[model samples]
Target: MGEFELIRHYFAAAPCAQGGVGVALGIGDDCALLDLPAGEQLAISTDTLVAGVHFPAVCDPLLLGQRALAVAVSDLAAMGATAIGFTLALTLPQVGAQWLAGFADGLGRMAARCAISLIGGDTTRGPLSITVTVFGRVPTGQALRRSGAQPGDLLCVGGFLGNAAGALPLVLGEREAAADVAGPLLEHYWSPVPQLQLGERLRGLATAALDISDGLLADCGHIAKASGVALQVNLAQVPVSAPLQAFLGREAALHAALTGGDDYVLAFTVPESALTTLAREVHVIGRVLEGQGVTLRDPQGQDITPVQRGYQHFRETP
Candidate 1:
């Protein structure tokens, strides 16, 4: 089928593409227009997922659709911004009606959940890949950033960590487990719920914030570097789900929580005063200190930082 016809039949006709608040002009226009409220700033983020590298070359289009958009929208949540709209640039080897329909359905479901609209994007023939750009808005000077963490702030995460990492073997078909063990882990990997509400509530409270796409330690290093403060991660305090521990064992689960990436949970720093106001789901794992890098502390307060922090796209090989 032709590009225009394909888009119209699949994505353009989806419920998310119908336009919502802040989307002035949606799919048909050359440039999508967004309306921002007075004294608010527009926040945007983009993420690309390649066929083999990011995900299995052959996988469920519905899950891929949900994952692609969720990961990108996590960026907006990190900044404590309210999601507005998104644009998807899809590159496919060939058109398949069934695949498009499933993908569009999943994407539309997630967009509706996040209260975000599908704005505009493009389609082309190529190796399979999906790029989603998300738009959000936050009041001026209120958006959380990575550079504002203070020495006395407490390091925290939105929810349980490492479930997605623990699910890797299951995702790649290398391992199998009971439904009880696999259900939660696989759900986390396939459909991570971005902590948008917690992020919005953290607007003025969180000094520095970001989504943990790259393991906890690596992502926390970013906060440390940006804020010029040391982060002391208490290994004992890091939260891990029961299912993950049951699946991978305590030690392995802890390791995964520390070094495995793609959790998409919000990691941030907030003052002691703000702790009382934080949601119940927030976990306090460490504290910010007047130092240079991230330091991992054992239960007894010994340094035990791992050699491998997290995934990097390109690194020197021995």
Candidate 2:
């Protein structure tokens, strides 16, 4: 099939195109249409994943499909937006039916789970890369942002950290791990669960919120910088999974949780008064302080921000 045909058959016609909640119209048109409730605003985010730089040069097409969409949608979750639809721009070295089939299947699975629809996009010839733009809806002026934090607010995280980072060695083929340890790690890396529900629940409760794509400390820095408040993170309170500790040991796991990126968990600031109102499980890591920048302190209160902040795209050698 030709380019347009390929997109139509494998993408626009996929299960994700079945018309989701906020999609007014999807695919087969000059532009897909989205609608927001009278008092709601639209949330949008874009992300790109390049082969070798983002993922292994040769990786499972299925997992890549899932990862690409999930990564983009995580932004919406950060804003406490309800997922609506997405557009995909795919670049392939060459067309292969098997690869496309697997990718479409994976994308469909994630779309169905998130209740998002595929809208419109493009496909082209080039090195392997995928760009996804996602849309979501949130009540006007109620969407979570990084600039609303206040002093004395409790800092919290949606779930465990460092599992995706712990999987990097196995993913790069530099190290080997047993199934019990590796399986969960790889799943965390490939299929990160976007905390959309939790983000929605936190809309009015969280003073400031963001999805932790970079390491927790690094992403927290973004919030601190945006909000103009100092954040003190308790190293002992950062959540790490038991499986990650078993595979990499507590020290390594701690390091991973501190500096390793791509966890995709949600981090937010909750007022001391609103803490009891949160219905979701979250680890209270620290509190917002009146100052500037992000500070990491061990149980004994020693400063230990990593010498390296986190992943810097062009700055860090791929």
Candidate 3:
């Protein structure tokens, strides 16, 4: 089929592309337009997923669709912005009716879940890759930032960590487990729910925040550097799901929680005074200190930061 026909049948005609709040113009237009309310600022983020690097070259298209958009929208969640719309640039080796149908269904599913509309994008022939650009909005001065953390604030995460890392083996067919064990891990890996509500709730409360796409240690380092404060992560306080522990053992699970990437949970810092309000929503894993960089503490409060923190696209080799 032709490019326009493919897009029309698979994406442009999809319910998500119908346009919603803030999306002034959607597909078929030269450029999509977004209209933000007065006193609100536009928030945007883009994520690209390649065939082999980001996901298995061969996998379920449905899950891939959900994952591609969810990961991108997580950035908006990190900023505590309300999701508005997104554009998809899809590159394919060749067109397949079944693949496009499944992918579009998954994409629409996630868009509905996040309440974000599909605006516009482009299609090209190439190695399979999907790039999604998400748009959101936040009050002029209330967006969460990585540069606002302060010493004496408690460091927290929205939910349990490392389940996605634990699911890697399952994702690649390297391991198998009972449905009870594999279900949660695979769900986390394939369909991570962005902590949008928590982020919005933290607008005025969280001093600094980000979604944990890299390992906790590596991503926390971003916060520390941006905020110019030391983050003391208490090893004992890091929360890991029981399923992860059951799948990888306690020690291995703990290691995954600390260093495994793609968790996509929100990590933020809030002062002691604001902790009460957030006590139920977050897990207190550490505190901010007057210094620089991330310091991981053992049970005895000894520094145990690992040399390998997280994934990077390109890194120097020794």
Q: Which candidate has the top score in lDDT?
A: 3
Tens-place lDDT per residue, model 1, 1-318, is 766466655677788999999989998767999999999999999999999999999999999999999999999999999999999999999888789988888898889889999999998889999999999999999999999999999999999999999999999999999999999999999898888888899999999999999999888888888898888889899999999999999989988898889999999999999999887989999999997778888899887735454434111121
Residue 287, model 2: lDDT of 92
What C-alpha lDDT, on a 0 to 100 scale, does residue 223 get in candidate 2? Answer: 82
> Across residues 158-193, which tens digit of lDDT does each residue of candidate 2 receive?
999999999999999999988999999999999998
lDDT of 2: 0.87
For model 1, the stretches where C-alpha displacement exceeds 4 angstroms are 1-4, 307-318
Candidate order, lDDT descending: 3, 1, 2
Which stretch of 10 consecutive residues in model 3 shows the poorest summed lDDT? Answer: 309-318
lDDT of 3: 0.91
TM-score of 3: 0.95
Maximum-TM-score candidate: 1
* lDDT of all predictions: 0.90, 0.87, 0.91
In model 2, the runs with Cα more than 4 Å from the true position are: 1-4, 305-318
Candidate 2 worst ten-residue window by lDDT = 309-318
Per-residue lDDT of model 3, residues 154-176, tens digit only = 99999999999999999999999
